[model samples]
Structures are given as structure tokens and as C-alpha cells.
Target: MSGTISRRSLSSPLSALALLALAAGAVTACTGPQAASEPEASRSASPETGQPVGATRHMIDNGGHDLAFYVTQGTGPTNVLDSGGGEDSSYWKDLVPELHEATGATVITYDRAGLGQSDAVPGPWQVESAVSDLESGLEQLGVTDDVTLVFHSQAGQIATCLAQENPALLSGAVLVDANLPPFFTDERIERLVAFSQPQLDAAKEDPDDPQNRQLLSTAESFVATSTAFHRATWPDTVPATVIVSEKTPFDGSPEDVQRWKGAAESFVQAGPHRTLIAADDSSHDVAKDRPDLVLEETENMVAAQR
Candidate 1:
């Protein structure tokens, strides 16, 4: 459940059985070297992993509501990260500071309202509300300089929507195992949701929990916004790179896997600036499974800023 963003599928494009298998396999399948990049061995990388050495926490007031965010100050561009559905800043625990160490850029991570250390907000879970929380947080943090966005899982919707609404604020983007909004069809999602009904019911019973709130919000509102986003013309001005898992996290049939890759390829064509890279032998929780690739793709985005 972490994308440096959560492992939550905004809507799985595959069958429920496959996704269940994918989740079960994701835990044990990635046994290799996903333990952050080697650059993290630097003195600045901090041994604690999640808590960076010099990072400090701050609260941004969104009309009396506070959004919790962290800052690891660096010298170059600002790298702002948005975690996937049901996750908060902690999702990026290991990668956040390591990223700053690698790039010498200001690295920021935040808990979307109702998750992590942030306060809760009422919601049908509208993407607009999530985007607003981020905007206020960034503005309050004085992010007026260059910016690169690293969005994971459900946060992909937020990143794309933000780019559409506030492209001027961004220089480049890295979509890590992000939601391919254009590829989700209603028939597929309806089936996936119906299959996930049991989990949804459990969360519905405890709706106040952060993950639950995020899950409910995603179920209620995220897809429509994502669909609408795909309907609009993609923003071609900003460069974006998509990092996908080499192995399907939600285990699908061979045909399912091929279709998923096909969709990823199509998504890469959204703009001339878009590129798609498949991480080696990873699952849906790709950031955790292959932190090295996440670091590399993010660095690629930072370099692509124009």
C-alpha cells in the first residue's frame, strides 16, 4: 500500500482474481535490490530511511484546515511528490531524502488531508479538492522556482489534473506506476469494483480511517475526474515520463498483461514529451519494489525540465 504512493489501484484494469493474485505476489516477488538507490549511502541519506536527516515538517493552512508536509531543503529545483490513494507522505519515506541527495533539489512530501498527519476534510473525494490541498500547500511553501512532480498510483490523476489546471507551476513530471486514466474503461472498472466489494465493505464500516476515507473517496469520485481528464486533450508542452512495472502487480492472464502493456504504450503517446520505461521484474508497488528505478525516472524528469 505504498507508491512512495500507495499500491491502491484507482481502478484495476484487470480481473479481480488477477489483482488479488497480483497483491499477494507483490509482497514476495520483489526480493532483489529495491532498497533505495546506492546514492543513498551518502552521509546525508540518513540511516533511518524514512526520516531524512535535515528534513522538517510544516503545516499548511487550507482555510483553517491543515495539510501536513515535509521539506528536505536542497539547492536546485523543487521536487514535489504526491502519494497514491490511501497513502500519505510516509509512502515516500525511504525515497524522499535520497532523491534530494541524488539531485541536490528541494524535496517535498505531504499528507493529503485526512491521511498521515493531516486533518480530515469532507468529500465525495473530488479530485478538485485534492488538487486544491496541494496548491495551497505548495504556495504556502514558497515554491515559486522550478518544479518537478513525482506522482504515484492514484496521485497520477492529481498530477495530470494539476498540470491541466496549473501547468505553469510545473517543469517536468514522473508518473510512477500511475493510473493510466485514458485506459480505464467503465466495463472493466465496474467489474473490478464489484469484485472488490468485500474490501470496500470493510472500509465502509470504518470510513473515518485515513485509508478508508481515501478508498471511499476514490470509489466515489476519482474515476469520473480521471475519465474527464482523459477526454480532454493532453497537455503537450510539459515533458512527462511514465514508469511501469515489468511484471503486472495484479496478476492477469497473459492477454491481460499484453493489453496492459499496450495501454501503457498508448499512454506514452499522449504527448511528444512522454516516455514510458518498464522497471525490471517489479509489481504494482513498484516504488518499493524498485526504488532504484523510481530514483532514476525521477532524475530523468528533473533533467527533462525545459
Candidate 2:
């Protein structure tokens, strides 16, 4: 959770609903086959959720916005490593390569708008737009593989929405301590919105600074986070598992842990294919604290799919 990120890198906070994997946590996933020699049809290829061949680092043109994304090729079903909340793709450093090696499938990771190298839209950030970018990014990349999406913390909203809307696109999913939309009530949403407003105000005042822009970007997106949860409908078709952390990181209260466990239990128990696991000796970042358990669940999901 502690590392030196060069000047003005406003990475999502460690506890702000996010998690990461590893494999040379360096910047720029620019290494792979050169895309220049590929045909236009091949380069502009992937289906909405399919994987692209011979493409590594690239920018996506999604409705006038340029989103920075990168892919590490592998084998099996495409695994989409999406971190939650203020996080970008870099957070999943430790887990990425493990899954890639285990599944032998192309792993897709990227910075959401304004998070890393992705460009920010001018208007206030919304959940729907963020999800749109992900779907569109895959299509633009010309990916059409069966995907097993991995979501953590706040990014759970995107997972649920996608599962509900496009069940056929996903083969299975892993909720790595994900946030269940139904668990967020009115009181919770108000508190989160309130906590983020001050930072947003300060960033607006100093809009020119890089740090300020980063703060502004997170704040704007967070504004609608709760509402997105409210609007989301959990899909019944997506076979998934909810991995819960025994140690509390998002909240310190004993009640919060119980609440999370309760939500996770209900989420997985709703369907026969789903299950819940209480990750032992783990924090919110379970992937880092207990990589074996995380990898086990991931591999299990792939096996079931196969």
C-alpha cells in the first residue's frame, strides 16, 4: 500500500474503495507487438467485451474522449481487472500477473477517465458514463472473448450494471470485496457525498494544479456514486462469489463488518452458482494481504466456466 509515485500522481487512496495486483508496477504497459503493421480492421477490432490480439498500450476514442488503456496478453477467458472507487488499473499489480499465469488469458487493465493517463470529460462525472467507457473501450480494442470480470470496492456498481445489462458478455465474475448496491441506503450515501464535498471545493478553487485536477476528477465522479448504486439492479444470471475481508479497512466499527458480511452473504446466497468466502487475515486489499486465497477463488471460477 506504500510506494513512491512520482510528482503529482493522484492515485486513488488505499482505502477509498480500491484494490490492486502486481507484475512490474511500473508505468506504461507499452511493451508488446507493434500495432503499426496490423490492418485497420484488425486494429479497430475487438467486440464490446472481446480481447484484442497484438495490441498492448493504446488510447480509446469513446465519444470525443480519449481514455488510456493497456493489455497484457495471456490465454484463457479474458480477465478484466477493475479496481474500485478512485482507483485506476495500477492498483491490481500483484494480482494481475498471477491471474494471467494461472488462466493463460489476456488480462485487461486501464485507468478510468482522469484516473491515470485517461483524459477527463469536462462535465460532472457519472457512473453510467464510466461503465460506458469500459464497454466501449473493449469494443474499440476489438475484444470478443468470454470475460470473467473482477471488481473491488466501488467498482462493484459497474460489475452489477454490466451483468444485468449484458449477461452474455461475461462467463463468470469475482467480487473481490465488492460493494453491493443494495447495501447502500440513503443515510450512507449522504455521509459519503458530504465527506467528499470539501475536497471538491478546494480542488475547484485551485483548478490549474495537477493535484487539484486529480482531486477534482475524483470528487466529480464520487458525486454520483451513491445514486449509481441506487439505480443498479443486481443480475441473477452472473455466477459470482463475494470475497469478504476479515479485517475491516473501509470502516472501523464492528457493526460495519457485520453489515458487509451480511450483504455479501445475501448476494451470493441468492443464486446457487454463487458462494461467499470470508478471507482470513486480510484487509480491504485482500489480494495483497492473501494472494493465495484470492488466486484460488479466481482459478476456481475459471475452472467452473470451463
Candidate 3:
């Protein structure tokens, strides 16, 4: 998939109060490595060509949370990764660096607020607030332009919001097993409420319990409360690629797997500048379960952009 953002355009600066509100809203909303060997074996056959690899890990203050990200520096547009629901940035631990090494494009992965090292906001994890936090975090990292966002699962929605409001900042987006907006139906909302009730009840019982608070701050509840906000704010245009998982659990039926894949495929087909790939060997956690596949697909996408 190919998409473009006009570099000639400029983003309106956020007012100080708006910035503070973004920060404050964020504050009130939520509440990897590798090694190598077999050098001689590689020498037996010509060594495989690969891009130079360089990565740095750092913590950035986003709102009240200390968000952690790994920046793999290279040429051209940077790839910003968004983790799946219920996962930390480590979701891309093995795959991102490989993509960077193979493609020579900068790759970034971060823990969202309330996940990993980042602290949770107080209440209502809205998508708009999340997008603001992302924009601010990217600004803090000095990566304010020419970005290729790679979003997994529910993050596709947040990425769409960012690209819509600030198209100049994004070059492209890849949605991996992404959750689309229109998919948020009343049945899904009911399911989310059912999924979040226990945690919400626990948090109500004892707000001081960090564990309970964290559980209550799940992405499901966050999406439920913020769906309207997302619906109201649509972007002008953004390029995207969508990937679907084809494998299933041992106990899962073929029909169940197909149903899940169908949902993902629908989202991909619905978007402009989108392509869908069904990874047969992988399940939901494609990055972790099939890093090679993730790396290969990412490299292909980045190369196409070039």
C-alpha cells in the first residue's frame, strides 16, 4: 500500500493550555535483546547482506507516565510501533530490530500509558487523549515528522486519529491485526463491559490497589468510552497496510479462526492504500509467534515505500 503526506503542509501549534489539557487529560484518562552465533557456518556460504543495525532504549515523560521506547536509527521515514491490547512494547521486541537491520529504516516501539513502565492516567482512557500523548511523546523524542506508524490490534484506531489531525507528521501506517472503528458495536460494548466489570468493581472497592486500578484500565474499557470521540474526529487521509493472522489455538475450530481473520480482512479492505496478508503460521501475537514473517512483511512494506 502506498500513501503520501504533503511535507509542504504545517501543523497548527498546540496552545499552552491545550498542551496542558492534553497532558492533564492523559493524566486523568487511564487510571528486548538478541544474540548471534555460527559465524563460521555463515562464512561457508557467502555472508548474507543486511542493513546496519543501531538501537537505543530510553524513557520519555508522556503526561505523567514514563513511556519506554526502542529507537532503531536508519535512513528515511521512521516506523513507530503501537502494541496490541493487554501487551507492553515488548510485543515487537524480536521483530522490530530485525526489520530495521533488513530495511535500514528507523523503527520505534513504545509502551502506552498504563502499560509497561508507563503510569496510568486517572480516569477515562480516551482515544483522543491517547493520540495527544503520542504526538507529544514523538515531539519529545525529536521525531516530529516523516513517520510510518505500525499499529497492532486496537492501536489502528489511535493511529488513524493522529494521521487524520496531523497528516504531515505521518508518511504511512501499517495495521497489524488492527481493530477498526465501525466494528465497535453494541454487542462489542456489552462484551467489553462484561470484560471490565470485575476490574472496575475492584478499583471502586479500593482505588489504592494498583493492581486493581491497572486491570480496570484495560484497552477494552478505554475503547468503549472513547469510541464516540474517535468517530467524531476523522482524518483527511492516511496510507495504511493491514495484516491478518491465519493460525489458531489447538482447541480452536477452523470456523473460529476464519471468523477472526474475516474481521481483520474487512478492516484492511475498507481502507485506502491497504493490503492484506494472511500469515498462516502465526496466531494473534504474530510478532512474537512469527518474527520472521513480521520482519519480512515490514521490510516489503518499507521497500515499497522507497
Candidate 4:
């Protein structure tokens, strides 16, 4: 399942984000492609409990990004968990092992550039750079195939781009309270751009300030432009599942929530190979607020694939 992507096909950050929001909801219209048959029940691991209990953690240099990752190998599909904004690889600490135990797959979790122990890049974080880093990391780890990408928040854009451009490298994708398409309007885009200037200026003033630097790094990483919004559409080949958050508000308004729902619904309607699950008690941090629900949905999705 080797996949290739042309540099020319990559979408701008705003475009990617828009397409992601659209693709994220379009899942309901898409059908799951026939996958290879799984082993008998006796051989399959329980999704509720996860895999045997050991994990190996390491740091790898993907280009210049110092990516810290943890691996738990299983007999099923490989799982790559992408952390949310300002979060590190440890974001999945409690949930990853549980997922591994239940599904019996090779599970991997990593810190994005500038977050956790990984060093941040010098400029604003560009979507292309993040994708490149992820691809490089996968190549370095040698788990290019048999991989299922689980993304949270803004990572949805990255995961969407990877699936669209390099579908062969992925088995499937799971999005947790992710930011998607249609969520970006001209006004929203302007707001995002406007919101980032202060942080950017702050970073410019004191590049060494950890808090200011982190703020600038995160803003630059995704919201610096509209490329992410435009590239959010799926290619109709990849399978996806979106776990929607019922409690958190991206913009803290009903109108904003409706926009988010519209974007999510767009993704579901665009593709047949998708599922939408709602988490009522949790906010954006689905993993932290309700690990049990996240684990359950993850199990269901994986089992369905198996």
C-alpha cells in the first residue's frame, strides 16, 4: 500500500481547512471499500480492553522536527494518533494503550513540531510542512502501510490532506472534535488572521519567551492562512469517522456551532465511508473529557473495518 503525493496537489492552509470541514461531514454518503478479511474471533483482540500492556517510546527527527512518539504493536491495523493544538504526544497517554489493548493494532502517538519535546520550526507552522513531517516520520518508522490516522482538533486538516493525497498509506482515519470545512467563511478567515497578529508580533518581539513563542508557533502552524480550509475535501477513496463534541464551542456562539455542524455534515454527506458519533459530556478534548467514549467509538470503528 505505498502511496505518493505530488507537491503541486497540496492545498493551501485555508483551502485545506475548508475541504476538511466539508469532507469530515461527507462521510455519511460514502460507503466503506471492501477490506481484507480478518482472523476469527479467537484471534481478534477485544476492542473494549485493548492490547497487552507494554509501550516503547522514542524520539525521531522528521526533517528538522524532533517528533517524540510511542509505539504499541499489535496484530491488527497500525494506529497513528495526532494530537490537538498546543498539545503534545502525551495527550493520548491514557487512551492509546486502551485502544491498543482492545484492537490489537500497532498504535503510535507523536508530538507535532513546537509542541511537547519536539522543537518548533523557525516560522509560522505551515500545513505543508506538517504533512511533510508526518510523512517523513512514517517513512522513518517503517509503518508506512497498515496505518489508521486518528486526529483531534486542527490535526483533522493534516489527516485529511494525507488521506486525500496519499490514500494508499492509510487504512482509515478517526477525527475527534476536529475543525473542518465550511467552518471557514471570509469573515471567519479574517477573524482568524486578525486574531493571530498580536501573537505573531509578540513572538517577533521576544522569540525566546516560551508562552509567547508557543502562541506564535501554534497560530503560525495552522491559522496563518486559508490554505487549510480549501484542501478539506476528500478524494472518495479514504474511509473516515468523525466523533463530534457536544459540549465545546469553537467560537462560543450558537451561530458558530451551527457553522461547525454544517461543515461536519458536509463531510459526512460527501463520502460513504464515514460515521458520526456524538459525545455529549465532552468538549473539544474528547480524549480527556471522556476517554471511555473515545475508546468505545474507536473500538466500534476498528471492529467495523476488521
lDDT of 1 by residue, 239-258 (tens): 88888877554444444455
Q: Evaluate model 2: give its lDDT.
A: 0.64
Per-model CA lDDT versus the true structure: 0.66, 0.64, 0.55, 0.62
Clashing pairs in 1: 2-5, 3-6, 5-84, 22-251
User: How many times do residue backbones clash in model 1?
Assistant: 4
Error of 1 at 184 (Å): 1.9
Q: How well is each residue in 1-306 modelled by candidate 4, as lDDT tens digits?
A: 112222122121221222222222221111122112223342222443232235554556655446555566677678888866556666676787788888988887776777665677786555666776677666666665767778887787778767766788876778887866656666666545554454466457976754456555555434434444554676576778888877434424455556667777777887788877888877667788888887887777677767
* TM-score, one value per model: 0.80, 0.76, 0.69, 0.76
- Residue 27 CA error for candidate 4 (Å)? 24
Residue 204, model 1: Cα distance from true site in angstroms: 2.2
Give the runs in model 1 whose Cα sits over 4 Å from its true position: 1-50, 253-256
In candidate 3, how many Å is residue 191 off? Answer: 3.1
Report the backbone clash tally of model 4: 58
Residue 277's lDDT within candidate 3 is 76
Report the candidate with higher lDDT, 2 versus 3: 2
The segments of candidate 2 whose C-alpha lies over 4 angstroms from its true place after superposition are 1-55, 194-225
Top of the candidates by lDDT? 1
